[model samples]
Target: MSDDMLRLLPWTTPDGKPCYLSAASDHSRLSLLADDVEAAQLDSGEQVLDGARAVLGDTKAGERAVRFALTRATESLEDVLRIAVSRGERIEAGET
Candidate 1:
């Protein structure tokens, strides 16, 4: 994967734990924490994996979504931070 893809979603672990991933030239991964279910609405490994596959999916689709959202090659770092914070808040609030 290119730097742009890395900057887009930023691979994470399945339990919402943050982890570094190699370039996604072939595959992509995201992690979720057990506690994220109460927030993000993703409860199981299957759910997490499915969600990742749906949203992140293959390179072409992922790149397209990112580009459409950001209207640029890179996803805004600030947006990523905001999303993380919002998800955390949702969990804390029991909104998920």
Candidate 2:
């Protein structure tokens, strides 16, 4: 099947394995669940960004606090990028 038939879900399995659904319809139950998870992740990432900025801007924030904020921000960004890349790849394949 073409890569376009594969959809990436935001959340992983119970065992922490990445979950991917192979189907042509984006309106399927699994697809809708994935969409919901993606929306939650995006919202979480935004919160992380805001908190990270606050921590960075605070003069009294300790190194450990800043480090933790940065770490969380990095992880959130990575997840967002992975989702974007997966969608982008499918789009690119479709255009070729």
Which digits, one per residue and each the tens of the lDDT, describe model 1 over residues 1-96?
343232223334578555442353423333243223223432333354454556565556766564554442122343345456644544554442
Kindly provide the TM-score of model 1 when superposed on the true structure, using C-alpha atoms.
Answer: 0.22
- lDDT computed for candidate 2: 0.80
Candidate 2, number of clashes = 0
* Candidate 2 lDDT, 1-96, residue by residue in tens: 263567667766899677778877777788788778777878999999999999999999999999999999998997797678667856776777
Candidate 1: count the clashes. 12
Off by over 4 Å in 2: 1-4, 13-17, 93-96
Return the top candidate by TM-score: 2
